[model samples]
Target: MKSLQLLLGLSRGQHGVSQSLAIDGVWGATSSNALASFRQGMGIAEQGLLAPADVTLDALRAGLPDGVPAALLWAVMINGSAARIEAFHQPLLAALERYGIDTPLRIAHFLAQVAHESGCLRYTEEIANGQAYEGRKDLGNLQPGDGVRFKGRGLIQLTGRANYRAYGQHCQRDFEADDPAQVSHEPALAVDVAGWFWWRNGLNEWADQDDLRQVTRRINGGYNGLDDRAFYLARARWLLRG
Candidate 1:
C-alpha cells in the first residue's frame, strides 16, 4: 500500500521520487498531507483515508485501476462476461469517492443499487417508453412529452424533469436546458448523478447501519427487486468486505 502511495508521489515528504527524502514507507504527518492533496486534485473529498478502493486509494491516475479491478463497475455482459470496465471505469470510482460514498458498506450498497438499476451498467436508459408517466404532475412532467423527454437515465436512472433540473442545479450543469440525454451519453455525469442522489438522500447512513431494507426503499421507492438487490449487495460484499 505504501508502495502504491509512493508511486503516486504521495510518500512522506519528497520520499516518493527523491532519494534525498527517502524514508521507506513511513507514513507520517507529511504523508497524510500529501494524500489529502492528491484526493483534492482528483476532485474527491478532502478526507485522509486509505481504503484501497474509495477516495483514499482511488486516484490512481498513474494507472492503478480507478477503483480496484473488481470494482471498476460491471459495464456489460457478453456471453455472460461483464466488460466495459476498460472503456468506462474512472468516473464511477471517482464519483464514489467524491460524493462521500467512502466506506466498504457504503460503496457496496451504492454499487449494488446502481448495478440493479442499470442492469450492471449494460443499459443506461430505461427500457420503457415512459408513456405511463405522461402528464404526471408529481414528477414535474407539466409540459407535453416531458415523460419521454425526461425519462430515467444515468447510473441510478435520474427520472423526470424535476429530478434532472434539481441535479443540474446542484452540480451547476443546467441539465434540463442542455437535455437529459447528456446524462446517458456522459458516463462520468451518469455516475456522478447517481452519487448525487445517494449522498443527498443520506443513504450512506442506512448502509453504515447495515439497513439494506431502508437503502432499497429509498433508492427503489419500495422493495421492487429486493432479492436481486440483495444478491448484488452480497456479491459486492464478497469482493470488498471479504
Candidate 2:
C-alpha cells in the first residue's frame, strides 16, 4: 500500500487517491474489483486477489513500460538501496527538461521508460559502451525499417538498423550501427537520440491528440493491447491537468 501510494505520488491522508484509483479502475473497495482493476491496468489476468508474487516492490521496479530494468532492479534487490538508482536518475530528469518534453505526463512517462530501460542507471556499463545505444544518441539508422545496426537507443529503446541511419541524418552525425559505443558512451548523444525519437515518432502527434493511452501505445508499442495503457493515460491525464 505504501509503495502504491509512492508510485501514485499520493499522500497518506489523500482521499482523492482512492477516488482516482477507483475512477481509473486501478483500485476498488471490493477485493475482487480491486484485483480485476489492477489486472486490467497491467493487462494481466485479474485474479481478484493480490498474488504473492504480484508487482509488489520488486516487480514494479523491473517490469517493462513503467517498471525498472532487470539490472538496476537487481541492485536494489540485493542492496536494498534504491537511493543509488534515484541518484542516477537526477540527470535524466534534467535531460528530459532540456529536450523540450516539459509536460508532467511526458516527463513521468519518460522517466518510466527510462526506469525500465537504463535500469535507472543500474547499467552504467551499458551507457559507457554503445552496445546499449539502441536509442541513446541522435544518430539514426539508414531509414525507417532499415536493416542496419545500432538502431533505436537511449530511453526509447529505438531499434532496427534503419532507425540509426535516420537519427544520424537528424543529428548530422555519421553513426555506424556496429558502433553503439559512440551513442551510449555520451549522455548528451543518448538524450538527444531519445528526444529525436519522441519528436519524430508519432509520439508528439499522439500527445497532441490528447489521448493518453493512444500516445503511450504509440511510443511503447501497443503491447498488452493497451491494458496497462490506461495507467499511462491516467497518469498523463493528471499531469496534463496540472
Candidate 3:
C-alpha cells in the first residue's frame, strides 16, 4: 500500500500526494500540519487530518466534490492501468455527461461503483478465460442431452442465465448468453445495465444522502451487506476526493 501511495504521489507531484502514510490511524502533529496544508491548497476545509469528509481529487477533476485534488485520478489510473482502466473511465464520463450525471456526487457514485465491481479495472474476467467474460458457468452436464455451461463475464461479474436474459430484456438488446467468442460481446453493456439500475431504482439519491448501504444494495444486490458497503463507500469517497 505504501509503495502504491508513494508511486501515486510521485506521479501527482507534491500537491497531489497526501503526507499521511496510513488513512486508518491517528495522526501526529507533523502529519496533521501537512494534511492541513494540502487541504488549504486545494481549498478544502482544513481538518488537519484524513476524514471521511475529506475531499477527493478525482471528484474535482470530474467536477465532482469540491476541494478534492485533481491528482488522485491520475494516481488510481496509473496504479491500475494494466486492466485498461481508461476503457471503463472514458466511457463512464461520456455516458454520465450524456445521460444527466452532472453532479459531483453522481460521478463519484459511478466511479466508486466501478472500483467496487472490478477493483478499479485491476481485474476483468478476461484475465481468466475470454469465454468466462459473459457471466456463464460450467455446470458440468450429466449426459449428452444436458445443457452447456458458462462463467461470469465482464466487470461487476454479471452472472447467471437469468441475469443475462433479464439484462437483455431490460436494455432491449439481444445479449448473447454463450461464451467469450463475442467481441460483439459489448462488455460495456454491463456498465449500461449498472447505470440503468442506478437510475431506475433511485440509487442516484444515495449519493446525495451519503447513504452507502442503500447505494450498495441497489448496485451490488444482497452481497454488499454492511461491511462491504462501508468499504466501497469509503473507497468511493476517497477516490472522488483524491
Task: Please report the candidate that would top TM-score against the real structure.
Answer: 1
Q: Estimate the TM-score for candidate 2.
A: 0.46
Candidate rank order under lDDT: 1, 3, 2
Itemize residue pairs with steric clashes in candidate 1: none
RMSD per prediction, one decimal?
12.2, 12.1, 8.0
Better of 1 and 2 by TM-score: 1
lDDT string, candidate 2, 146-194, tens digits:
3234534565565655565677787787665347546666666666666
- Per-model TM-score on C-alpha atoms: 0.68, 0.46, 0.53
The digit string of per-residue lDDT tens for model 1 on 1-242 reads 34433344422233232222222456676656666655555666746556646644434533333334532233111111225454446787788788888876788788788777877677778889888788988889999999999998887888888988899898889866776798888878888889999988999899999788999999888999999888888756544542
Writing each residue's lDDT as its tens digit, candidate 3 over 1-242 gives 32234223332335544554432233455445555555555667545333444454332334333422333443433335533544565555555654565576766665666666666555544344323234323433232322222344445554444555565687665545444323114546545655655665676677778766677776676656456435555555555552
Q: Which stretches of candidate 3 lie over 4 Å from their true place?
A: 1-79, 126-151, 169-172, 177-187, 223-232, 235-242
What lDDT score belongs to each candidate, Candidate 1 first?
Answer: 0.69, 0.47, 0.49
Judging by lDDT against the true structure, name the best candidate: 1
lDDT (C-alpha) at residue 22 in model 1: 29
